[model samples]
Target chain A: MKLTRYNPSTLTDFDSWFRQPFVGFPSAAQVFSDSGSNRLAADIQEDKDNYFAQFEVPGVKKEDLKVELNNQILTISAEKKQTAGDTEQTYSLSRAISVPDGVQGDAISAKLENGILTVTLPKAEHRKPKTIEIA
Target chain B: MTTNCCNPSPTQQTAEPEAAVMKPRYFVDGTQEAYEVRVELPGVPKEGVSINLEENVLTLRAKRTPSALSDWKTLHRELKGLDFLLRLRLNTQVDEEKMTAALDHGILTLKLPVKEAAKPRRIEVQ
Candidate 1:
């Protein structure tokens, strides 16, 4: 089975329909716009048994974080609050990643340490490769 | 055949180097008594963080703990392993001896108290 890469900034349905004619040309506005706050950077890795996904979420408390998996779509969300003097501000961040087949969703686990969130997805037993001997 | 002696060989050229230093995101706010600074340093541990105050400038540096995933294959990558550095020039006078700092959940918070002499004073009319 093939796995689709995680891309947070992909255009939506409405955007794709409107920008179909200008697919080859890049927009100047997008080149200079600052989208760092709206998107979270992530690193995805895989081994023989498990897949790891890591994200940076500084200044966010564990209580304010939410992780959910529905229809093979894993979503992570958090709200970061900052207070200065008398004024307080809250920033919301969210990201979604598509999980591949043969994963044990029930046994998946997540951990947050040093402002980094790591999600581990273990592969199923049948997904492991087996070697057979010929007589 | 002519030899290109002046030009360096392709093997001598070095590969692209990774970014050595990065400025971490930070916020600063000031009130009547003190100034508060918050710096975001993801993946940095307490032992790798350092703060220095000299003259009117404050410098902060943090190093992230190295990862031990050499055997894993990377499917997608966006985060880089780089050290964090930030420098700020303080305009107001602060008491360095009374300053305090704390690190929690990868966020460093610093409180620099305003000097007594620098605080605003009111005078009554004669």
Candidate 2:
């Protein structure tokens, strides 16, 4: 959706109008917007005693984030809002994943920093990854 | 996962690259006073981000720190350990000197403030 009437003519029609030497390739503006809900990229990392999930949730305020854990299920939701003039806009995104067995529900911790959200889930006392030496 | 994050920014930037640099997905929103540009750059550290504006062109580059997975198993592959690279042609209307940028939670935001002369002004009553 085009939110503004301002057209970036300089950015879009530079090579075509001015740069004659660069005739083959004119347009250089590569604009990408992933408004899809599934585009929220994430990664899962695990250690001996804990599982850590790191994901990109930028431009989302802390108060707009809603995270819930229930029955080994983890759900993350966020809403981003921007107000300009008389227009108020909102972008809502939600993603969920299932936690492995033996993770401590009470110990799950989440932190949103620098537009990145990191969630850590600790393994139960006896569920830690076992390391055994070969005989 | 789609863009290769190792190549350099293109002089005449295009939609696709030569599998050398990672072109992150981003969105640009503009207001009368400022234009907000947000790019997704997961795991990129503070020191890894670099932004340069020359003439009417802006280049954005960042390197992402790898995850903490010990003995990783490739059951699924989506997000890659990559570097972000993007080049954009800025209009003369953009005030580069007044531009500001910030990175938070894997997102990079660039605030391009409009020049006073470029901004629309309200006329006083006669």
Candidate 3:
């Protein structure tokens, strides 16, 4: 379904016109809306011991990904693009996570492999190894 | 013609200053020769671009000239950067050598053919 009037001169637009393309959904103008980076489908797993955050970033490179931490808030951002004459397409995704105090931001570690980005935030030393006294 | 991350502009001097959003369309057809996947990436020039098969994955990345940022008098807004990344995981039965890509008027066409053993065959009646 074409949301706009048809332009016969551009064959490229005619080729992929959907039958019922929704306005909200990403179109040629909004392809980046559903892009791997900006619209992340992530899962955050947490336990009594630690918190695990896994972000989905398909078709992204390690060099293009960025991770930042400020005031106990962690942010992850990535950008990927394809440029042509008179057209530059860019896809970007960013997410900010709130972390409780006492967790060391300096010790955070992140790795990107096979399009999935995994971030590991270890618990503080004092938070572990509690001594149980016999009553 | 250099496009900056600070500005969302296309390099075409005559083209309007409005941001250009690219939509890469594809046509996929499976046949006896192979499964053909043709992606439409328009305005891509033909030079210093490579298509390679690594561990059954088809990756397409090209380094082209920077887009023209001079089209705008003052950089007000920026949306996308200057680059392209397209990657695909191929089927085991695909013939990588037979695959080819061509760029014309911003359309990128990729032809991937199938392997002989994977093609469907009719059984002879005894």
Model 1 regions more than 4 Å off? A1-36, A129-135, B1-19
TM-score of each: 0.75, 0.64, 0.40
Steric overlap count per candidate:
0, 12, 17
User: In model 1 chain A, where is the ten-residue run with the lowest total lDDT?
Assistant: A13-22
The residue-by-residue lDDT of candidate 2 on B24-88, one tens digit each, is: 87766666777777777767888989998776667888976655555643222345657788777
Give the C-alpha interface root-mean-square deviation per candidate. 4.8, 10.6, 18.5
The residue pairs that clash in candidate 1, if any, are: none
DockQ of each: 0.38, 0.12, 0.03
Q: Which candidate achieves the best DockQ against the true structure?
A: 1
Give the per-residue lDDT digits (tens) of candidate 1, residues A34-129.
364655667877788887888888888899888887777677888988886677899877766666668899989989888988899898987755
Residue A35, model 2: Cα distance from true site in angstroms? 12
Question: Per-residue lDDT tens digits of candidate 3, residues A35-129?
Answer: 43355444444344444556655445678789887666566787755444336677787765555545667888987643456676766776644
Q: With candidate 3 superimposed using the best TM-score fit, by how many Å does residue A5's alpha carbon deviate from the native?
A: 46
Query: On DockQ, who's better, 1 or 2?
Result: 1
**What order do you get sorting by lDDT, best first?**
1, 2, 3
C-alpha positional error of residue A36 in candidate 1 after TM-score superposition, expressed in Å: 7.4
